[model samples]
Structures are given as structure tokens and as C-alpha cells.
Target: MSENDPLLNDPLLDEPQARRRWWKPSFDRRRILRWSLRGVVALLVIAALYYPVGMLLVHKIDDDPDFQAPATPEGASRAVALAAALIDREVGDYGWPSNDPFFMPGWALDNMPNYQQGIIAALARFSTEMRDQIGRVRGTSQVDPDLEKAAGQLSYSPTVWIFDFSTSWAPTASSEQQYLAAAKTLRSFNNRLSQGQAVFERRADNLQGTLDRIAADLGSASAVLDKQVEEHSGDWVDFQADDIFYATKGRLYAYGLLLRDLGTDFAPVIAERDLKAAWAQMVETFRVASTLDPLVVVNGRPDAFMRPSHLAAQGFFLLRARTQLREISNILQK
Candidate 1:
């Protein structure tokens, strides 16, 4: 082919030129690095936008309030109301003219297990409700060491579960012995409750009047126990009397602890009432009453059949505690 031929000079026929311009790209180190830098910058921009947008969404979706806020006087009052209702219900359940007729003499003995069930249900319910209420109160109430301490003590597992009862009223000698032992335990438990009364008085300047009312109720219960022993001199049914005593002690201890704890939680609320003189009187009442023991003396006499006197003391305390609890409820309501 001649050097001047048209095909030889045509661009399509230029092999080397086509190789440089079309077959290979300008992929030098500087060009590659520049493009890489642009990619990195794009990634950085995307990350920056993504993080803040994600955080903003998270913040918007999470609306929980801080629970560490100090408690208000209103919160303290609400705590008192919750506790007072528990006290009233517990006392009323054990007192004479009980709403649950299964607790009366003939039925109570026959359906002892059922009686136990009713009491246990109430106790469990009280614990659950109190825990929820106190947790909410603590979120808002001012720091209170005595109140916290009382709540700690009261938060213990249900004490009733510590004693096991036979399914039926028909008792073997072993069952009778078991019940008497439980009765003694109940008395000792009451002593423990009496000792804890001091916790209520720890911040007495704040809780004087409410503490006083609780102490008076305790004293009345103790007095009834003493009076019962005094009036009944001769033989007594060991198991029956002890069981009755156990039941009474249960009522007193539950009532007393709740009353005292509520008093602790409601100290600020009570102080707001400005009943200084009344509170002073209440402190005195609690002090004097604390010195007096429940004076439970059931085992001294010989064993006999169950009698009205066996339950008289328990009934008295129940009634007195109920009345006092109602009064406390009224005070809180006002």
C-alpha cells in the first residue's frame, strides 16, 4: 500500500492513537488519589448527617421524666392515704363484725385454712400496693432517712408464710403443738414491732401528732392483752388460747407497723398541719405506751376447752385499733 493511501491516514486506521485515547483511561496516581479524597469527603458528610439525625430521633422517642426529683407535700399526703387505707382494711378484717363471716367462731374453726387464705391475700395485696406507692413517692419526696428505714423494715417478705397451718380444723396433737408454737412466734414478732416504734420518733418534730395517734392504738392493744390475762385466772385451752393470741398479735403488729411507717412517710405533711402542741402530746403518748409491754401470759394456766374469754382480748384490741385507724384516716383526709 502506498504511504499516501486514504485508508492508512484515516483516524480509524491509527492503531497507537486509538490505544492511548480509547483503550486506556487516564488512571494516574494523582487522579486516583483525588477521586479517593472526594469519596472520603462524601462519606464524612453522610456520617455527620446520619449521627445527629439518629440522635435527634432517639431523643424525641424517649420521653421518660427524671424520677429522682424531691417528693412534694402532696406526694407525702398521698403516701399517708395509701398507708391508712391498708391499715383500716387489715384491722377491719380481723375485728368483730368482720365483713367476711368465715372468720367467726363456728366457721373460722372449720375453715381455718380459708381464714388463713383470706388474711394472706390481704397481706400480699398490702405489700404490692405499698411498694408501688412508696416507689412513686420516693421519686418526688424530699430525702427522708427515717422514712427510708421504716420502708426497708416493712418491705420484708410476708411473715404469715412463716407459719404453716393444717388444712382442716380437725387437729392432731402435732397440729395443736404447731399452732401453739406459732402463737409464741406471733408474740415475739409483736415485741419486734414495738421496738421499731422508735424509728417513727427519729424525726419526731415532723411526725409528732401522727406518731402519737399510732402509739395510742398500740397501747390500747397492749392493754387489752393485759386485761384479758388478768380477768381470766384459772385454766385455759393451751392451743385455742394461744391461737387466739397469735391471731390478735398478728392484727396488732400489722396495724402498728403500717401506722408507724405511714407516719414516717407523712411527717412533712403532718408538720404542714402545724399541730405543734398536739404533736408534743402525741410524742408523750408514744413514749409512755412504748414502755408498756403487750403482757401476753397465756401458757401459765392449765389447759381447758375454748371459751369466749379466750378471744375477748383479741376482739378488744381489734375493735380499738380499727376505731383509731379510722380516726387517723379522717385526720389525713382533712
Candidate 2:
């Protein structure tokens, strides 16, 4: 084992031999380094194989945006949405974040629906102003009814694309933990909507029961009051009749006052419970849904939370409408 040993004097000692250890890979370390060194080359091979170069696959399974409403107001939501749209407009048409460079760029998916929807709104306004140019060409609009129809139909259609980016798609801080958090957020939001609906249905049922009880009470009380008047009619036949008449009028007045009191007490509560509260709950459903990357075509290619073009915004609206409808139907049934 001595450095000056006769074995070290051999010609083999002049050069290093390729060696392997049980703990290490058998291939030449250099060969392993060769693949590592060929980084871009390996990426190119992967790109060529599962190319997203064709129609941009803007989505996988897009959830409804309402359920994932960002924790913000309408104006703030619009601003966030516009920013998202701007990114998509600037980035999506070029690629579906297929470049991987901008795919999960911090705020992209976070601001998907509102940000991108805002983009669509801006583009629609621009397109609207440009629509006047059609007047310059006489009868041209008439010739293309489909174009005219499309223009008219485009009035409210706001297209939006939503993509659900899991930590699986891209690395995040403690990806497993982050995924769990995102999943929890989704489940929590969903549960909130569910609980809200449950609350609404229960309130509706309770109110219906209250009304039924009130009606029964009113009927029973009316019968007793009417009988009291009828029994005393003989005291001063005509006088009792008039007093009875006035007493019944007072009783009706009392009944009406009680009903009014019940309604006045409950109206605001119902408003909050049913409409405004339901709406807020529903909005969250849209929010969650919007967080999803809804795919839309731009320049004949699908794109993600891309810029606020007509296509992207309209996609959002469609998605929103679909979600709202589902929620409405669900709430109604509940």
C-alpha cells in the first residue's frame, strides 16, 4: 500500500484506470456526464417527441372559475383579470406557456380568469370602436349575414381560458406541501359553497315552516274571535253586529300588523341569506372555476390565460355563465 511500492512502479500507474464502485453507476462517469452535459439536446429530443407546437393545448380538465373566486372585489378582480389577460395576450398566442419559461411565472395562473377576462374586455372595446368602420362599406355588412350575426352575437360573449396548474406541472416550494395546500384551498372553497347552499335551503325550509305556522295561528285565532263576536250578538243585536264588525276589522288589522312584523324582521336576513349571500358564495364558485385555465383560440391556436382578446374573455364569460347556471340550478333544487 506504500506509494513507493513495486506495484506502483508498473506502467499502469502512469495512467488512471476507469473504475466503478458498488455505490456508483457502472457506466463511465464521463459517459454519465455526457448525458448531463447534453442538457439542451435532451430537452430538444423531449420537445420533438411530445410537441405542443401544433394547436396550443390550452387546458386539461378546466374547473369552473366561480368556485375559485380570488379573495377580492369586482373592481380589484377586474384589475387582476386584466393583468392576467395582458400576460396571456402578450404570451399565450405565442405559446401555451409551452415554452415552460412563462408557464407558471409566479402570478400567471393565480390571476387567470379576472386578469385575462379584463384583457378580453379591453380587446372587445377596441374591436367595438373598429366595428364602426363597417359603415364605410355600403351593403357589405348585408352581404355577410354571418359576419353581421357574429358582430351582434359578440356583444356579450366574453371568452376566457382557465388552466389548473398543480405543483405537479411545475416545481414549487415544498411541492407536495404546496399541492396539499392548493387542494385544501379548493376543498375548503367548495365546502363553503356547499355549506352556504345548505344554509340557504335550511333557511328556506324554516321560513316555509314559519309561514305555515303563522297561517295556522291566524286561522285559529280568527275562528275564536269570530265566535266571540257571534256569541255576544244577542246583547244589542244590531249594536253587537256593528261592534262585532269593528272588532273583526281590528282583529284583521292586528293580524296584518303581525304578518308585517314577521316579514320586516326577516327580509334583510333573507336578502343576506339568499341573494347577496348566495351571490357571494356563487361568486366564489366562479372564482375557483376562473382560476382554472380555460382554453381559447387566438390566431387559430389555443392559448391559456393569454391576453384579453375577444376569444379569451368570451371563453371566460362562457365558462362563468356555465358555472353560474350550474350553481343556480343546484341552489334552486336545494
Candidate 3:
């Protein structure tokens, strides 16, 4: 059409020019794109800063002068509760029978008749501490010696008599003779212990289940203690915070030994199966467990103890480790 045509001469004649103008980038478009890019960059910067800031804040809060661990009786109660749960899941809730090799009379280690009896004492103390704390919470002061005794009787240990008795003596004839006699006496005991450990090792699912149960128990106890701290703040005024920290430290120390024994039992299997990643994950889990030591609560004051945070952290670390351990178990199962 001619440019001078009536339709072209009309106001709508500029429509093509307007369309071309619209197609061209304007200052507004440039400004918008620039701001959009800046916004995207700003978001990335914030995302990058998020983790470091969070970690620093956590460190500062944990290191604050007011930071305190849970009260002693509370920690003791948790330890007892977790131990009881672990025992209940592995052995019978009432513990192994008197005739079991891992039981008191048969729990000897190189003539040490009462070798793992400390486990019994600690198990019994769970009830003692729990009752004592619960009593104090309710304005009472009494303990059931009978209950403590009964708890001890119900204590169990999977690793109690699973030692290498063959290595207890040399390969000489005299040693062999002595070992023969000892071995004869312990044949039934050794067989039973071996069978128990074998059953545990035969399936990765079993190990995973054990770790999952332990982690669940620990997490549950930590949550319960968190609730207790909130509910019984008045009861914690003189609850001996340092003593609790030290006691927890002691528990962690003992746990280190348990971890060592576990590593010893499973490391070879992991190596044999060429499960390097699984082994590393297990190592990391143990490392996290080790972090729950004296350094976390040694110098903190009683009133300043962040009971909820500390317990939550403890439970979290355990759960993380348990996850890794369960992964290892899964790998072995595969």
C-alpha cells in the first residue's frame, strides 16, 4: 500500500513504527535486566553466606558463658534409659538367664569372675537414678534397693565373653594343655557367645536394626530429658551440673571403648568386603560419637547449661552416626 493512502495516513499508520520501537530494547528493559541480574547475584551471595553465618552463630551460642549441660540426675536418667532400651532390644527385657554364659557367674575373663559386673552396676544405677530424680521431682527421697538389685540381675552384654581365648596362651604343649582344660570348661560358653555374635554378623540387616534401635532410644531419651528440663527447672537449681557433665563425659569415655570393640569386630569384615566408603562412614560416625566428650561441657556453669540444645546436639550426632552405620550395614547386606 502507498504511504500516502488514506489508511496509511491514518493514526494507525504509526502502528508498524510502534511495533518496531517495541521490538527494540529500551532504557527500561536495560534497567530491568540489570536489576534482575543484580537480584540473582544478591540471592547467590546470601545463599553462600548462610552456612558460615549459621555455624558461627552456633559456635558463639555454644561458647556463651551461660551455656550449660543438662542436670546430673537428668543425664544419668537418660544414660540409664538408653542402656535399658539397648539391653531390652538385644536380650530379653529382664536380661539373659542365669545359665547364660554372659550372665554374672559365667562372665569371667581370665579368672575374673565378675568381669563385666560394672555393666550390671551401671544398669542397676539407671533405676536408682531414675527413681531418685523422679522422687525429687515429686518431693520425695527414697530408693528401692530391691529394684536396683533386680536391675543388675537383668543386665546384658553382647561382647561379654566373645574374646579370643586361643590367644590367651601360647601354642606350646603346656599352654595347649592349660588352654585345653580351660577350653573344655568354656566349650559351651564359647559356643554360645560365638553363635550370638555370628547371628549378629550373618546379616547386615541385623546390625542396621541394632543401630537404628539404639539411635531411636537415644533420640527419645534426649527428647524426654529436654522436656524434663523445661518442666522441672526448679528441681535443677542444685542438681550438680558439673557432676552431670563429668558423668556424661564418663559415659562417653566408656562408649569410646565400646566403639573400639565394635570397630575391632567389624573393621575386618569391612576390609574383607572392600567396603572402603562404608568403613570411612563408620569411622566418621565414631568420630562424631567421640565429640560428645568432656570438652563439650567441662568448663560450663550449671545455670547456664543449655539443656535442650546440648541434649538435642547429642541426639543429633548419635542419629547422624547411626545413619552412617546403617548405610554400612546396608552395603554389607548388598
Candidate 4:
């Protein structure tokens, strides 16, 4: 009998057919197509909702302004981000980057202090970034402790970053003209010599007043000494007393001379000359004072320091100081 023959269809076979399962039925093309279409539609809806959201995420991960600081704002940063994405394609582990340096160690930059010869003009970009960061911090007093401390030690003027015409020359850019104008306004220098001259005279007068007080104190002390000596007609000689008395008198005389010289020096600072000239000269003198190296540690001598650090001397520490200053000044500007 044939397999499809009715004679072969036994009662037991019919019983098994009666207990049939629906889920275990043969696969259907229509069912598969329907499910596939449903899946695709779901994906489309999700993508439509997340397209802008994904853009935001991408921007945050790769194009964050803070992350790209000290970098040029042109196409280079975008190129970097694209190149990063392509590199991730080849390496399965690097596909989705985590900002954690530990997880994505490839981004770790090496030898920031070292120069690269094979890569020509690599440092050019970094220096350009630094120049830009410096300009961004104007009018704000965001002070970096490290840079402030370092600049304070060197007496480097914060305003010098803007004011020093010789060194603070603006770059050949449109923005620089504005900076130059600001610098000029901030200076607002007067043409006449009278103002600084007047200030200098006041300082000199103060010195004179101080000198008069010291003179009075000394005179009173001197009279008392003379009267005491007169009281003792037959003096029991005190050798140490004479030494102490003479030393005190000598100190007073030296102090008086110092005050007189200071007054004399101050008299010239306010001399009635070209007012602009006086201002310029006074500013220059203050600049000179600011340039004096700061004494970081106390030495036995008045001008001596235990350890000296400066921009030219301790370059590494100075770099750190500069970075701190950049951050501080940025905050202040905001």
C-alpha cells in the first residue's frame, strides 16, 4: 500500500493526529514577513525619536568645548572626532569609547614636555592653542593660585599680559585690534606731569613727618640722658651703660639719615615736569619693582632666599603656573 493510501491510514495514526500542536506547526512566509515588518517599524520609530538625541550624545562625547580647549575651533577638531570613529570600527574593543582614561588608554598623550621631530609643526598647534587661551582672559580677575604665586614671586604684573606694549603686541588678527584698543583705554594716560608729581610730593612730606617724630623722640631721650649725667656730679663709671647709650644714639642718627635720604629721593618722583613723562617714569619704576624675583623661602640675609623659582629658571613649574592662571583667568572672564 502507498503511504497516502487510505488502507495505510490506521486508527492509531488518526489518534496521534487528533492530539496535534498548533505552535509546532510548519513555518509560514506570511507570518515571518509580518513579524519582520513589525520589527523594522519599531526600529524606525526608535531611530526617529533618537536621531537628535544621538547627535547630542555624539557631540558631547567627541566635540565637547572643554575637552577641545586649547585646540583650534576650526575643522581640525571635527576631523579628529571622525578619525576616532573610523578607528573604532576596526578594533571591536574600542568601538564605543568611554571617557575614562583607564578604559580608553589609547587617548593618553605622551611626553608633553618632549619635542617631536618626525612630526613637523606638531608643537605649533599646541602653542597656537596657548596663545588663544591667553587672549580669552581679559577684564576678569580669575586668579590661579599656582600662577598667581609664581607671578607674585616674580612680581609679574597680571595687567602686563595686556599692558606691556613691547611684549604684549597683538597678533595680526582682527581680534587683536580690539585688544589693542582695550589696552589703550585701560592705560588712559594723561599728557601733563602734575598728577604724579603731586603724589610724589605727598610721599616725601610723609617721610618728613616721620623724620620729625623720630627727631623728637631722640631729642627727648638725649635731654634725659644729659639731665641724668648732671644729677650724678661724681659719676660711678658705668662702662656698659656708656656703650649702650652710644649704640642707641648711633642707631638714632642712622635712622634720621635714612629718613632724610628717602625724603630727598621721593622729592624727585614728584618733580614738576611733563606729567606724561612722570607717569611713564613712575610706571616704569613700579614695573621694575614687579620684575624683581620673589623670595620664596627665608634666608638669613634680608634679600636671600632658600629656593628660587622663576619662569626662566623653573620652566616645568612655570608651565603648571601658566595652566593654573589660564583656568583662573577664564573663570574670572566669565
- lDDT values of the candidates? 0.39, 0.33, 0.39, 0.29
**What clash pairs does model 4 have?**
142-328, 153-294, 192-275, 193-274, 193-275, 197-270
Error of 1 at 309 (Å): 3.3
**CA RMSD (A), model 4:** 27.6
TM-score of 2: 0.18
Model 2: how far is 66 from its true place, Å? 16
How many angstroms is residue 58 displaced in model 4 relative to the true structure, after the best TM-score fit?
Answer: 77
Candidate 4's residue-wise lDDT over 1-334, tens digit each? 2466543466555634534532256889999999999999999998675645543433211111122112222212222222122223211221221111222232231211011110111111211221222212432534323222222222222122223456647732222222233222212211011233111122323323433343344344445444443443233342233322332322232232232233234334334322334333333332232223332211122222542222112222222322332332233233
Write model 2 residue lDDT over 91-136, tens digit each, in one string.
Answer: 3432222223343332122222323233333333222222333211
TM-score of each: 0.30, 0.18, 0.34, 0.20
lDDT for 191 in candidate 1 is 38
* Residue 214 error, candidate 3, Å: 2.2
Model 1 agreement with the true structure over 206-253: per-residue lDDT tens digits: 233333444454455456555556655354544444443543444344
The backbone clash count of each candidate, in order, is: 4, 47, 4, 6
Off-target runs (Cα >4 Å) in candidate 3 are 1-201, 228-256, 267-269, 272-274, 280-313, 329-334
TM-score of 4: 0.20
User: Order of all candidates by TM-score, from best down to worst?
Assistant: 3, 1, 4, 2
Query: Would you give me the overall lDDT of model 4?
Result: 0.29
RMSD of 1: 26.0
1-334: candidate 3 lDDT, tens digit per residue = 4555555456864867755655676578788999999999999998777655643432210111111222223112223223333333223322322123433332222111121222333333433333333212232434333333333343333232333354554333231122223212222222333444211232334334444444454455445435544554444352333333333322333333333334444455656677666655655554554345443332222255453334434445555655665566566667
Q: C-alpha displacement of 79 in model 1, angstroms?
A: 11
